[model samples]
Target: MGGSKTSLAFLVLLLIGLLSGTSSDAHSLSYNFTINPRPRPGQPWCEVQGEVDQKVFVSCDCDRAEIKYLSPLGEEVKSMNAWETQTGTLRDIGDLLKEHVSDVTPERHMVTDPLTLQARMTCRCEDDRHISGSWQFGLNGQMSLHFDSENGHWRVDHPGGRWMKEKWENDRAVTEFLKKVSMGDCPAWLQDFMVCWEKMLKTSDAHSLCYNFTIDPQPRPGEPWCVVQGQVDENVFLSYDCGGAKIQSTSPLGEEVKATHTWEIQTETLRDIGDFLKGQLSDVILEKHTARGPLTLQARMTCQCGENGHINGSWQFGLNGQMCLLFDSENGRWSVGHSGWSHMKEKWENDRAVTDFLQRVSMGDCRAWCKNFMVRWEEMLKSTASPTSGPPAVQPTATAIGFTIGIAVGVAAGFGIIILGWIIYKMR
Candidate 1:
C-alpha cells in the first residue's frame, strides 16, 4: 500500500509540472531569448524574438542547464538526451542546432507560451556574454536565430528591420536632419540640402547651428553653409539642392533667345503631409510705396507645393512652418501668381533663366539669379547655386525696372511648361 501511494503521488506531481510548462527532466532548461538591432531612440518597443533572417544570440540563467554554445562559430550543436525538437512548422536559428545535437532531427523547437503567442524569456548564462548560431537560407519564412561573429561581438542581427519589414515600425518622418556646426551624416554641400535646410526650419539657432553652403552666396553666410552627409540604410533623400535655367545660346541679333534649363526636381517622402510645399520661387517687387514705412513688394510667385495650400494669400509657409515648398503633386506643376507690371508679367508668362533661378531658390539658394539677391536680402540666409551671367539686353539691370524685367524673364519662361526667386524691389 505504501509503495502504491508513493507512485500515485509522483504521477500527480509529474502531471502538474507538464501542465505548468516547467517540466524538467533533471538537466533541461529555458532561457531569455531576444533578437536585435534593438529599437531606435523613439521607436516603438519591439521585444526581440521570432525575427526572420536575423542573427541569433544565445544565453541562459546561471542555475539552469549549464548553457553551452559551440564556440569558434559554426562548430555543431551538442545534443542533450532529455530534450527533443518539438514537432512544429516554426523554426529559427536555435533550431539549426539540431544538426549538431546527436539524435535530434530537423524538427524545430519554436519558443511559444501556453497561449501559442510568441513569448520572450530571460536567457542569460554566466560566462556567455553572447553566443552566435548559424542558419541556411533554406530555413527562411519561419523564425530563425543565428550565432555568428561580426566585428567581434555576439549580436542578434537581422537582414531586414524588426519583424521582417523593410522600414521602421515607428512612422516618424524625421530621419535626415541638418546641423549648423556642419557636422553630421549629411551636408548641404554634398547630399540632400532640404534636409539640412529644413533642420534649420525646425531649430531656432541658425546663428549658431547652420551651414552657409557657399556654392553661391546667400546673405552673410547662410554666414556659413556646409553639408556633412551620411547614407541611411533605409531612407532616401528629401531634397537639399537647387536648379536653374541655363542660357543655351544668344541670338545672332543679341536678343534673349534659345536657352536650355539646368534644373532638376526631386522629392522623397513615404508619408504625405496634406499641405507640404514641394518648392517655391518668389519675386517681390515693391510697387507704390506704402506710407507704413514698411517695404512690401507686389510679391508674385510660381510656387510648387501641394494641393489645398494657399499662397501668400503670400509665399506658402512651408507645411506647418516646416522649411519646404508645399504644393499639389498631381503634375508637380507650378502655381503662378502675377499681380503687377506687364514686363514682369511677360517674364512670368515665358522664360527659363528665371525658371532655373526659382527652382533652385525653393530648394535653398537664391544665387541662381544674381549673387547680389541673397546678399541684399539679409532677412534670409543660407545659399547654393552655380554663378550665372545676367540676362540679355532686354533684361533690365540693377534698378527696380531691371528687377521687374528679371522676374518677367522667369514668368515668360513659365508659359513654356510652364514653369518658375524672391527679389525685393522699389519702384523708381
Candidate 2:
C-alpha cells in the first residue's frame, strides 16, 4: 500500500510540473502593449511609454522624445519611439526582431527617450531588470528590440519610421521618369503601320457608301451605251444611252425621262419594196376578208427605228403575185394605200399626202409598211388554199423502160455465153 501511495504522489507531482511548464511557455510566447486609456493625444500631460522585461522606459514626450542606448563601452545602439516597440515575453520579442532583422542573434541592446519624466518611469517591470551583453527599451515608450542574427547588432521596430514614405516617393519619381522617356508623337514608321486605321474607325454606313460609289455599273441598250454605277454622297446614279436615245433614271426614287429622234421612212421609199413583197404573196386583206383581195388593208406593224431617223419593217404580199395594198407609216401617220399591187409606184408618188398622214398619226414609214404587209399577207392566206398547198402535182409512173433495159441485159448475157462456147469448141 505504501508503494502504491508513493506512485500516486509521484504521478501528481509529474502532472503539476508539466502544467507549470506549459503555462510558462505560453506566457513567454505571447505579448501585447496598449496605451494607457487615461492619456490622450494632444493633451498637455499626455505621453507615450513602454516596458521590456519589466523595466520601465519613456518613449516619447508630448512634444517629442528620443531614446538612446549605449554599450558597456558607451557605444550608441538603437533608439525608437513608444509606439514603435512591441511589448511581449522573451520568446515573442525574439520573434518580432526576427521578422524585421534577418538572422537575428539572441542578444540585443536598445534605448528610447521620452521627454516627460512621468512617461519615462511609468513603463517599469521586474523581469527586464537584468542586463548582460545587451538590453532593450522602447522608443517613445513603445516599440521593441532584439539582436540581428547577421551582425549580432541590435535593431528597433519603429512603427513611425519614414521608410514607407520614402519608398512611395521613389516609386513616384520612377513613374515620372518613364513618362518623360516616352513623351512625343510615335515614329513615322509606326504612324504608317496603321494604314487601315482610318477605315476601321469609319461607321458601317460610310464604308457601304464608299463601296457602292466605286464599284457598280449601269447600262442601257441600243445606243453606244456605257453605264456608270456609283454613289455620290449616299445616292446612286446610273446613266446609259439606247441607240442615240438617252434615258436618265434613279432607282428607289423611280424617276425616269427619255427623249430620242429617229428617221422617218417615207411611203415613197417603201413603195419600191412593196411590189417585191406582193410578188411573193398570194393574196391580201383590208379590215375584213373577202373573196377578192382588199385594195387597202389595215396592218399592224413593228418598226425598227435607227438613230438616223430611218424606219424599216418587212412587207408581205398576196397569192396572185401582186401587191394589193401598201401598208406604210412615216413621221406619225400610218397609211394603207388603196392602190392595187401594180399601182404601188403610183401610191408612193403622193409624197405630200403620205407625209401628212404619217405626221398626223405619228407612225413611221417602216411602221406603215409592216402594217400593210401583215394585212395583205393575211388576206392572201385566206383567199388561197392552205399555205402548205400548191397544185396537186401528178406523180410520174415507173415506166416499162426499166423492164426493157432488163431484157436487153439478159439477151446480151446469152450472146456472151454462146460466143464463149463456140470459141471453146474451136480450140478443141
Top-lDDT structure, candidate number: 2
lDDT of 2: 0.26
Instruction: TM-score each candidate.
Output: 0.15, 0.14
TM-score, model 1 to reference: 0.15
Candidate 2 per-residue lDDT over residues 40-122, each given as its tens digit: 24432322322222112223322333422211111111322212232222223223322333111112212221111110111
Measured by TM-score, the strongest candidate is 1
Candidate 1 on 237-347: residue-level lDDT in tens? 111222212211111211111121211211121001101112111232232221222111111122211122211111221110011121222222333211223333344
Q: Determine which window of 10 residues in candidate 1 has minimal summed lDDT.
A: 228-237
What's the C-alpha lDDT at position 259 in model 2?
19
